[model samples]
Target: MPERIRVLHVEDNPDHALLIRRSLEREDDSLEITSAASAEEALGLLEENGFHVILSDYALGSGMSGLDFLRAVRDRGHDIPFVILTGQGNEEVASEALRMGANDYIIKRSGLLQFKRVALTIRNQRETFRARREKEEVEARYRHLVENVNAGIALARGDRFVYVNPKLCEILGYSAEELTSRPFLDFVAPASRETVAERYRKRQAGEELPSTYDVWALHKDGREICLELTASVIRDSEGISTLAVLREVTRERETERRAQRMEETLDLVFRQAGEAIFIHDLEGRIIEANPAASRLTGYTREELCSMRVQDLHVPEEREFSENKLASARLDGLFGFVGTGRCKDGTIKRCAVTTSLVRMGERTLVLSLVKEVPERMTSHEEEWVAAAVDARLKAALEKAPMVAVQAYDRQGRVTYWNRASEELYGFAREEAMGKTLYQLILEAAEAEGFLQELRRVWESCTPAPGREWLTRDREGNRRWVYSTIVPVVQGEECV
Candidate 1:
């Protein structure tokens, strides 16, 4: 059901009041009428009851007239719509009532037409008041929201500050009165002023660009602040203006710059380092090769990056390289001596240190390959070495009882089989490239051992088996029967 309108009807004559009520109810039954013969009685009823509309006599019998009553209600901030009634149906009196803030006015007549007209005026008055009140409430809430929001909001005409919210004033450290009538670019840092102006000019010229970006701004105290500003062009009745929302991004932007600087530093180190570094993905495809790595392989950096780890391995070492890579993925770190094919189709020897590393979301391998002296003289020599290496690998892994070892011409242990590891109490990996006699003989026995080794090398003869005392890895003296034989490689004892 529709809500009934509450109306206060004020008139001096009882007959006129009855005529107005009966005529109004006959046409529309929605009006709930209350009687007041004088403005004084109407004021009392107004204090107690909330009426949506009010009808009053133009001239009251007591107290003030209807126009005076309307002024009083408005002065007291009452939200009731008051209409006036005149006995003579004169336009002059109706005009005077409306001029004094009466929502509407009606002229008394002998027929019921005046009653219907007054009912319509009351309905119109109620609707207009309700709409006006709601509009005011919405504006109040909007003003509060803009004032308290964190993002700074501002309006500009050309370069001048036209309007700014409280948040904008707070951000700039200025009062609204101080900021208004000032050039907006005055707050921009000197270094960023031209860039800001150019963007604004392009926007006004209808050119498309980024609507939001970072810029440097200045505070009232002359501190430089980074601002991320989003702006748009607004064409209003007055002219074209710019509306902007900005926030401080100093911390966030500086963090990004610091991260970029760190990346640059790391890249510089990688390019300038002495170690050969190759970075590849989990699938063995080379992603990056440092200058040292490229130089050692006799390939340009771009050429090396386009090749896979296996591509650089010598044909015979390809399987070994691939298997080592797969094993490194599981172990995270691995190393092995590999014969690689260089760019000029020559054999290059290197010991590669490979490790798995994580960069952001991708898994990669970072390898450091150090070049070792080439021992093979030709392809035929390499094939012979490869075959010997195969048998040597089996003996190192499967035969721990027979101590088989090899030494270079410099008297450094090049290969230590598994049997040597068990007999000497030092793993093969720990004994490679170490001076043989120093690792096994004590200081007191070192001189005699060197004399014996030199004699065996020069004589090309095998020394008789002799019981000798040697030190283990723990420096404990132990007894073993040892024979020395001169091993020759390429006309040299090795």
Candidate 2:
């Protein structure tokens, strides 16, 4: 079947005109044929018609013959395809029809299928001409794009160059013909040949491979150039091939290498540092302990890695350690004095500075610790205050006749001597954290004592060491002398 074609048929005999339509209709009913009995009548119809092809008889019985009609149509610029049919075979007459621009010439057959053959040939010629024009248009677009694209482009097969755009030739210092004459790897630097070869071979062998890779190519002048190559597989009528897009990355690669070296140097310095350094994960488990850390803790690297930060201090000193960590968590960095327990049960006082550090996906605490001699406390006044308080406590413990005690701003018992334990009938351990008024005073007296405690802490006034009626464990009323003082931190009691 072919495109629906409209035909103008000029035949004197109605039977011959019917025969022509039948021949084309033998394959499909796509031909619309209009008949005219004379050359003059066909000319009139042609002037008012749209037709794809024309068929005319050799002798129309009119003054004009089929060859005359064909020549007249071409001269008038109609240019429609014309075919002629004759009842007799004459070499001279067929030549005349062809010379007059008749697209075809056929001898009339009463019992033959020659008209179908003519119809098939005409359709084939029209299709071939159309296909040629479309191919030329596509090639024009491809040539324009490949010549003006910014990046270098190359087409290859079997890892051998098949074609290269002008930009690729410029990048490699070669002409398009020169680049396509050799293997693509011929321009690759010697050190990068194996990598480039392996990737291309795998791709050509139909194996899965990365779509992009970095390769170093040797320039014609012997200098190395880094190229980031993005590639794709092109499948067309020409068969399978690789298409590569190349970008220069020499400066970017140099910057990356320089930054990598700097990181390596910093890692080495951190490992060989003189102070005890540690990296602990967010869960408080030791992840990395430097050489100084092992020596400082009297533990091997393996031993330290199995412990949490809480495991390194005595229970009494853990609050101070926890406090330092809490401060570091809030501020991102902090410094504090704390005591650390060694593997042999010896204690080492250390000044600890901790900060948050992020490495890859994990967030960690990085600590730089230096040992502080036990006898070299930093603040003289603080040490003296502590010593004087300890002496007063010991003196009160030995004075059996009197019950002496100390309270924090909240009236919690911090210093409870032995005499307090005996008088209140509460063990030293039980009395340590309880409020003094809650332990031994009646409700009314306890309320009054709390009011006076608040006033003393507020005024920085001592409680005049007054005597009060307080109860003992036996529920018997007993008289005791008490005093209150505030432990101050900056402008507030702590």
Candidate 3:
């Protein structure tokens, strides 16, 4: 069953009121009618009951007229739909009632036809009133949401802002009136004006483009602010427009730029450092190594990354290195002289410095290794002097037919004779403190030379003499017979 419409009917005559009630009930059973003998009585009923529709006689026989009653109801905040009933030839009066806020008017007649029309009018008026009230409620909710939403909102039409929400005014540092009165591009930074204009034109033309992007905007105070906007085209009865939501991203972009600059600076320093630097985890596994570290260890960067820090130390020095690392972890920093075993199996005397540092949640070790000369103690000097004849050393230094050069375990020049300088086109001063690979050998040949030297160092004996096609500093290739031998002091090979 449909909900009953509550109708308050005000009439002077009882018979006429009965006739209207019977006719309306015959036409539609959904109406519930209550009669009032006078306008004053109808006012009392209105106060006591909630009625959906009001029907009143144009000429009430007492206190107030129909027009007067309509005015009173409206003044009292009752927005019920009201219909005026007037006699034939009273069209002028009905029009006047309508102007006074009457919803509709019906001609009075002595039949059921006029009352039937009244019933239909009541249903139509009720629906109209409900629709109007529902529209009002929806508009209130929309206004509240748009006003309180966190992001800035704007409606743009014909290159100007048709509407700007309060949040948008706050973001742009302008009043709502100022924002709406000016062209939207006036507030856009010069750098972004062209882009904003192009996107607007394309969107109005119905072109598919990215809906969200970042743009620089000018604030009221002349400062530039980055805003990330999400926009869409809206086409309605009022024509095409663009609705946009914006959020400020200035801080986020600044942070990203700073991070990028810091990374670039660190990379430049890492590449230019002279001493070998290594970063390893608590387990002594190498994580990162600079170019100098790779060259010093005679290993490719990728190969070193896969090895442990302890793996770079000579077998006899590994336990000592481990103890130093443990002490560095507890004390924050430690330094010692240790021997590093290169990939070619030769050992280098390095002054090792280790520091414990934290990166986020992980504690890491940063190690710096610089090559140093190996000095012999008195006992070791005595042992070495007893092993080598001073006459043979002097003879070899003065030999003109042979180019004899000796390198420390790290492949750095320890001794370069006059004949060696002529053969390699490098003076003794230029060759000293320089790696043999850097002085005369090409990168491809350095590995083979290191391998030969490794054989002599590991076995503590002379390597078999071999023929090598080497390059001079002037790019001339020369063949020479080379022999690699290790010098031992006591039990340790240098």
lDDT score, candidate 3: 0.82
Q: Which scores higher on TM-score, 2 or 3?
A: 3
Q: After aligning candidate 1 to the native by TM-score, how far in Å is the CA of 316 from where it should be?
A: 6.1
Worst 10 residues of 3 by lDDT: 383-392
Give the per-residue lDDT digits (tens) of candidate 2, residues 13-102.
889778767777675467777899888889999999887678788888747888788888898897677877766657678888887777
| Residues 97-142, model 1: lDDT tens digits | 7787787877777666767788888888888988998999998998
Candidate 3, which segments miss by more than 4 Å at Cα?
107-116, 315-338, 351-369, 374-494
RMSD of 2: 25.5
- Candidate 2 TM-score, true structure as reference: 0.50
Tens-place lDDT digits, model 3, residues 1-494: 88899999998899989988878887989999999988889999999998999999988886788888889998999989999999899999999988888899998777666777889999999999999999999999998998899989999999899988898888889998999888999999999999999999998999999999999999999899999999999999999999999999876676566456646766666677776888898788998999999889999889999998888888887788688767655554445666788888888877666665555567788777777667867565454433332324444576544677888777788889888888889999999989867887878788888877777778866676566768888889866666675555444566
The best candidate in terms of TM-score: 3
Error of 3 at 390 (Å): 43
Angstrom error at residue 136, model 1: 3.2
Q: RMSD of model 3, in Å?
A: 21.0
